[model samples]
Target: MSGEMTQGCPPTPEARAAQRARTLARPGLEAVRVKGRLRANKWLLLRRITQLGILALFLAGPWFGWWIVKGNLSSSLTLGVLPLTDPYLLAQSLAAGHVPYKDALLGGAIVLAFYLLFGGRLFCAWVCPVNLVTDAAAWLRRRLGIKGGKTPSAWTRYWLLGFTLVASAATGSIAWEWVNPVSMLHRGLIFGFGLAWGIVLAVFLYDLLFASRGWCGHVCPVGAFYGLLGKTALIRVTADQRRACDDCMDCFAVCPEPQVIRPALKAVGQAHPLILDKDCTSCGRCIDVCGKDVFRLTTRFDRSES
Candidate 1:
């Protein structure tokens, strides 16, 4: 959401402590009872606000004739003044041998700097429309206790990222955008994506049937590019109370990238308390679900150990 990931009414210290005594199969269910609904879903609701608010801004032009923001997520001009462009899209243009104009480069730079300061996959967790679809599938999978299909390589996204760039160079086009689920979802909402909706559905099914978070985590080149950009992110989720963790693993159940949790949550050696993995989405669901108040959203510079 806002990188702060801190808002809404929080529960009392006693209510928070109530969570340590219970671990539910449904993530956050215990928190819902102990911390109240709003506290349990604080970050998630904030992310929905951001995601839906961005969509509303984009749709305002077409539906209401009010041009708050022109263009979609790939490129946009806000209030006829500030230009915000997707840097990954800019990279594809470069690979396609297109000489981007000065304004375009400026737009990309503005966005690049913003994401660099925060975590890059903030786009994935907070804004991208397809994320809603994928998240639904993941929720359904977990609810159904569906397990074991195909475990896609976590490295698959990196390879896909390279292929997209090389394909753009070879084809002289932004190759990946041709089938990008995000673009398709945006177009589908405005007008009609037609058969393109199938690709989006395919992504959902893959996550539901094949694996949890199969597409965004393992296959999407866009996520891979942003994950790489996130390596130097200043905003981080830290395990400030790792010592209080009861090994309930609720954080893992809720996290999109659970692999990023251990280093911070179990910092035994030289590991810092910060969740430093580039793949950490900074989605704040970990913060939302941790009953012990183990995880926190803060600057990467904080060296406080749990």
Candidate 2:
């Protein structure tokens, strides 16, 4: 008896009832009804607007003859003046033995500086077009409760990031761009939907059936690169009012990177309230779903619990 493992007790009836109550109500269902749909979905709606708006600027040139923006997501000159280059893409080019012109470097710096200030995966939540597809897949996954997917290591993305650079150097080409879903998604819409559609669909299904947030959180090298870039970002989601948490777990359900929340929300010292984890998307769904208003967007310098 001393050497053998003992059986564990089942959950108490009260605990079971609580679980039932939490499960019966969808995450943020109360917030949706009580806060009104618009207010409840404010951050999400804003994200959709920003994501679509950026895509619209890119699409305008081809679809509407506007030419307001030139080139694709990899590199672009907005209004023939503002150069926005994806620094990660530039890294791949350099690995492939290509030195871009000064504008490209400058554009990369501009983006790098922005994410350094505002957090990196904000790009994932607020601007990337494939995010729309992934978000839709995540929403459907939650609604359907289709669980039991593969749990890949989140570190996989970092490894993939390293692999990409090495692969580019070895092959003398930007290897990841050959299958980069973000670039494919952007170009597909601009040109035609053929292979891009498949890439997007594969990503959608990968997240839905294989893992929850399997790609962006655990597999995408771009996210891994941006995460490293914004590790010390000034902007962050802070659990300032965590004492008000009633164990609703809505924030956990909705967060893209749920792993980042627990320490900030439940840490012994309330002074450590900022979600400083680089994987955090700064998506604001935690703020939106928490009826207690426990989370908010604030700078890392802000230690004020108020």
Candidate 2 CA-lDDT value:
0.84
Q: Report the C-alpha lDDT of model 2 over 72-133, residue by residue, as the tens digit.
A: 88899998899989999899999999989999999999999999888888888888888888
TM-score of 2: 0.92
lDDT (Cα, tens digit) per residue for candidate 1, span 1-306: 111223465545554544333332377765566678888889999999999999999999998999999988889899999998889889999999999988789999999998888889888999888888988998888778787898789999999889999999999999999999888889787766696689889999999999888999899989998888898999888998888766666888778888889878887554678899999988899888766678889998997874
Candidate 2 lDDT for residue 30: 58
Candidate 2: stretches off by over 4 Å? 1-25, 268-271
Q: Which 10-residue window in model 2 sums to the lowest lDDT?
A: 1-10
RMSD of each: 6.8, 6.1
lDDT of each: 0.84, 0.84
Candidate 2's error at 52, in angstroms? 0.2
> Which pairs of residues collide in model 2?
61-67
| Candidate 1 residue pairs that clash | none
**What ranges in model 1 sit over 4 Å off?**
1-25
